[model samples]
Target chain A: MAHRALRIIAAALVGGVLSACTTEPATTGTTGKGSSDGKLVLGFAQVGAESGWRTANTKSVREAAEKAGITLKFSDAQQKQENQIKAIRTFIQQKVDVIAFSPVVESGWDTVLKEAKNAGIPVILTDRAVDSQDTSLYRTFLGSDFVKEGQEAGKWLVKEYEGTSEPVNVVELQGTTGSAPANDRKAGFADVIKGDPKFKVVASQTGDFTRAKGKEVMQAFLKSHEDIDVLYAHNDDMALGAIQAIEEAGKKPGVDIKVISVDGIKDAFVAMQEKKINVVVECNPLLGGQLMELAKKVVAGESVPRRVEVKEGVFTQDEAAAALPGRQY
Target chain B: MTPPDDTGVGGRPARAPGARQLTEHRLFWPAAVLAALLLGNVALTHDFLAVRVQNGHLYGSLIDILQFGAPLILVSLGMTLVIATRGIDLSVGSTVAIAGALACEHIATAKDPGSLPTVMSAIALAVGVAAAIGLLNGFLVARLGVQPIVATLVLMVAGRGVAQLITDGQIISVSSSAYKMIGGGYWLTLPFAVLLAAALVAVTSLVTRRTALGMLIESVGGNPVASRLVGIRAAGLLVMVYVVSAVCAAVAGLMISSNVSSADGNNAGLWIELDAILAVVIGGTALTGGRFSLGGTVLGALIIQTLSTTIYTLGVPPETTLVFKALVVIVVCLVQSPAFRARLSRRRRATAPDRAPAAGDVGARQQEVHP
Candidate 1:
């Protein structure tokens, strides 16, 4: 039994080494062939198609890469940090001109970023930022300010109920617990809403950023608190869910209980057009055209800003109607 | 069966023998525990048991518990049968995602998504495909001799990918009112999902108890080698149980998707298999397999749903919600354990010297019989 175990271990070791050898040359060969054609080769690792927003982001990146004539080698991480790291390593092995990715989470990218830096490849962060203290690891970061998004949502609600003496009891449907967007959005909204004594958040719970859970939690919220006047959902999906619950409860969503959500997805626009959702602060996923521009500048050895903030807009019912014609997500 | 033991201690009035026998029933403790939890909620939350007719339909916490618990009851019912055959279906959650995705995808791409024919075809495709996946799992475990855990684990991982591929990794939204009624509509002043679950439970009970199927499953679970020797067709029974479990999960998936009018492949029915397993265990269906109770499982599912509703009603902090749920579950499981109750009763009798020896003798006989 001991001898058999040893033999199995030996076979596994040999197989691992053989697989490594085969993968190494394949990446290098692609790099050599691409570079000989004198085209800017870029490696973009996406956070997978977990949501409609992510699918739109991936589509934008692919389309922009084609339009800009950049040889973009794309990898979908499928929402796993380890998968993102593996894709980054593959990018480094291929000696891509530049690397860009929207991270799944905020931390644990120090080692992989360092590896890319050592390979003399410039890294650009897109759509989401990392929490690494060493800013020198990446060339620049570009994404929506989630905190600002939440503050905008709060600002809209405050304006809508500006002179109301009746206290506006707001119930917040938070995103996934402890997620960066969830925490920042909650903080920013609370900070802005604290200025008004008439505005008070009655109940808050994490809906885990899914429509089903959002609906279920909203139903419970409706049962527990009968005085809720406003619903501040961290995302449009949750707002949509809350709309269903409100309708089922025989109350008008946008009129009886106003909804303000973030993420300017197409469904959110449609919901606003239907007057179910009151307001939506855009967390734009169309960063592909801008990301390609940055990649080209970096490859050409040109200096760029360390932070590029994407311009976002808030859409009310009227704005939603106008933008519904051209909404991409 | 003894006369003296039937007498109530501590100067309490002696209870009737029939009442004592009812309390000693296997399902009595679990049912009592569920009732106690509901009573606690009533004491805390005003209107906990209030039922009002809204738009000609029932609306209340009790109704919500039954409506929400319907899917779980279905999943655990299937799980009870599978566990009775000494197997588990860990892939039920994945099957749920796949079924929802298939149904939603079919409806979304259909020429007329709202038509009855379209909805019927969508349901058929989803349930049929889910059953095929279950058959694959059964083949791996029963025919190829794979461990049950490993066999189901294959689909548990791969089935999600298949679902994602089918939906193209997007939440497929549909607007089929006919399909929506299955989950979110009201029929005869009750939620349709609740009525569907009740009908399925009744059919399952009749089929299992009225025939020899339930006994054969128990025999196979008790001793597979002996069952096979006795011509029980254990492999076929195992396959049938798995297929049934998958079909139940499919129905649950349809309900979930219909409720939201969208199919989120990644999040729909996520981690539901674990909840179903917990329900089965809480219902006094041993994980080791043998005797099972469908009624007890239904009560177990309701208990879980009520606990969830209670958490939100009580306003427990979101961060500690899971911990609070685990604490309650631990207490319920401990209270349901016969061995634990027996030990506690023995210790109490030891404190009373007059009844110590007599109770000790009964305890010894119980241990002998159980062992």
Candidate 2:
């Protein structure tokens, strides 16, 4: 009895070990809102509530739809591409005015976008872009420029140590290893800092964009290299975690080790206000207003840009303190 | 005193027919593998095994292994019992996420997040809710006669959503020093998490061994029908194990979220169930059920914890990290496995049967004693 159970458990463990069993952000259109006469009906598909950024993004979309007086047919694709595809099909069947979705991945959207295109329902991509050669499938893509955000962090680092000529040892707490943000941020940071001989990325490792891993890897980094001058995390949570690690190591975070992170989550602002995080590069999640505007434009048969980038900026301790009073996420 | 295993002397009496004594030395293989892995790390970092004190707290790779491995040790400790009952609770990871989420959300919304009372209530809420989940899982598996895996799988999938609901789909960050003490803060210059895990292990060992409960659980797992016929309440035992597993996972959840001072519903305790199961297996606990070892699970968890630290200390390239980790785990599994040991010894015995005559004699005596 035990052997069989062990085998099953072992098999289950092996087969599903790597899979985080993500809750695919798949939502079927319920059309819960009152579909008022003459109000533009917009179909929006969201990625799952995987993080604070995603939740804030979802809120921005929902709230913007309400404020814009547009009827939103919202569906959540819990991180599953197939769910997003299914949600898109439902939007097409419902014949909504405009269909908008954040592509869960970079591929497998050509067919669905084509379907929406054939139905004469204009599709707008938000937050994520699909790798479709046929650009006509979607009207516009609205998202943050991750590479630019990484460069902003690097630019801040260069300016912070502008007078210093000594070689600076830096460490990185990267997001998920193969994630778009992790790759782009690392590349952009490296691209900017590469020109300066004094700036050096001493060690870099993936923190999986999680707080626990962020702290764990930071601990390991501190033990391995005691002379780390700066920590460039791909996201705020990791930076916050590294701050705790730095404090535990008996060093002031902003003083001993300058911490730079991406994602302007509220927690990052709090950390900055506390003088833990040195700088935070904002990856704005409030794209709902722009998305609503683009949806209205596409529906009215007006020309829109092929790609739209959300405006974001770098924040330091002073800005973080000023912004913490009313920051949303 | 009643022994933990039902078998008087050896744990593998009926399971294996030959060389049972050598294979049943449960702690030897895992401990040896752990030592080897540490030594391998030493080749890279000279202070791999050195212990130092900084800020009145012990700072070393070994301490890191124990401190960081505390959660896994707790989860695997509970899993050891669950696996001992011929049942598995796959919902542990979800339970962990839910626990952290609930605690963090509570503290984040509390009137005073940093207050001791607030932290205590947050912990109570998480644990209380976990106990209820365990009751549900236990009810489904024991009372309703559902397969343990299937019973727990329902929650394993839905629990994340529940956690997200609690945190309103956000990573609830709290600044509670009292709460952080459970996971990140030290007590008496040692990680409180390590001390908590050690205390739990000691209590569990005393309760399960000093009494006949351990034998009862073994008997129930060994043969459910036979144990039931002997008037043992197998259903109750099943419920107890699942509850224990859930509670242990809840504590692990607290430690994790406290360590980071935040609870990320989607990522907290993600993929931990597999790690706990792997720890239980590596500790020489059979997933099939019966005799178990808590000490082995602790060593196994530490081994896993050390394996990850080893990867970073070696400065393994990011691209090859997963493959490198997999390779080391496979090596550990191979070394711990008795079949692999027997195969190696078989080749050795065949090559020099006459030269090492005493080895053959010992093997014969072992087989004679068992058979």
Candidate 1 stretches greater than 4 Å from native: A1-32, B1-19, B346-371
CA error at residue B157 for candidate 2, angstroms: 0.9
Tell me the TM-score that candidate 2 gets on chain A alone. Answer: 0.90
Candidate 2, residue A47: CA error in Å?
0.9
lDDT of 1 by residue, A101-214 (tens): 999888999999999999999999998899999999999998888899989998998899888788889999999878888998999999899998999888898888988888
DockQ for every model comes to 0.38, 0.37
Total backbone clashes of candidate 1, pairs 3 or more residues apart or in separate chains: 1
lDDT of 1: 0.84
Writing each residue's lDDT as its tens digit, candidate 1 over B1-371 gives 11122211123333334564566555777798899988998899878888899889998888888887888899899989998888888999999899999999999999999999999999999999989988977876687666677678777876887888898878888899999988888899999999999999999988998899987888887778888898889889889999999999999999988888999989888899999999988887778777777877888888888888888777787888899999999998988776677777777776886874854675545534431
> What lDDT tens digits, residue by residue, belong to model 2 across residues B1-371?
11344233344456444555545567878888888898988888887788788899988778888889999999999889989888898899999999999999999899998998999999999999999999888887787667888878878887987998888888888889999999988888899999999999999988998899988998888778888899999888889888999999999999999998889888888899999999998987778787788888998999899988887777787888989988988988888664566666667888876766765555544433331
CA deviation > 4 Å runs, candidate 2: A1-36, B1-24, B349-354, B360-371
Pairs of residues at least 3 apart in sequence or in different chains that clash in candidate 1: A266-A329
